[model samples]
Target: MSLENELKSLIIAELKLVDIKAEDINDDQPLFGEGLGLDSLDAVELVVLLQRHYKIETKDLEQSKEVFASVRSLANYIRAQQDRK
Candidate 1:
């Protein structure tokens, strides 16, 4: 599967988003606010999800904002990090 789709699955599974499915998520859809209705706590869970699954560590707050913007962005970030390794 595509990284974006994989990320969507991971996000939904890790965050326990019982109301949503991977197919329901859009690549460019916002993860927070009105998009997926994610909150700060979900952001924290996302961080843990990245580390646990992708071995990624997002330490910069500003960068995290961009990295966590959407499923596409998260997939890009994961790919970039993997490329570095």
Candidate 2:
């Protein structure tokens, strides 16, 4: 599957999101607020998820904000980080 798909699945599973499937996630949809309804704690879990799954360490809070913007954004960030290695 595409990285975005993978990340979507990861997000759903990690967060134990009920009534949602990976396909339900829109690539450009916000993961917080009105989109996925994730909160600050969810953001922290997402950062840890990235590190655990992709070896990506988002140490900067502001940077995390951008990186976690959406599935597409997170997928792009992960791909870019992997490319740098």
Q: Evaluated with TM-score, which candidate comes out highest?
A: 2
What TM-score quantifies how close candidate 2 is to the native fold? 0.97
Tell me the TM-score of each prediction against the true structure.
0.95, 0.97
Flag regions of model 2 displaced more than 4 Å: none
lDDT of 1 by residue, 8-57 (tens): 88887788889788999999999999999999999999999999988899
The total number of steric clashes, by the backbone 3 Å criterion, in model 1 comes to: 0
Clash count list over all predictions:
0, 0
lDDT by residue (tens digit), candidate 2, 1-85: 9999999999999999999999989999999999999998899899899889999999887888898999999999999999999
For model 1 the TM-score comes to 0.95
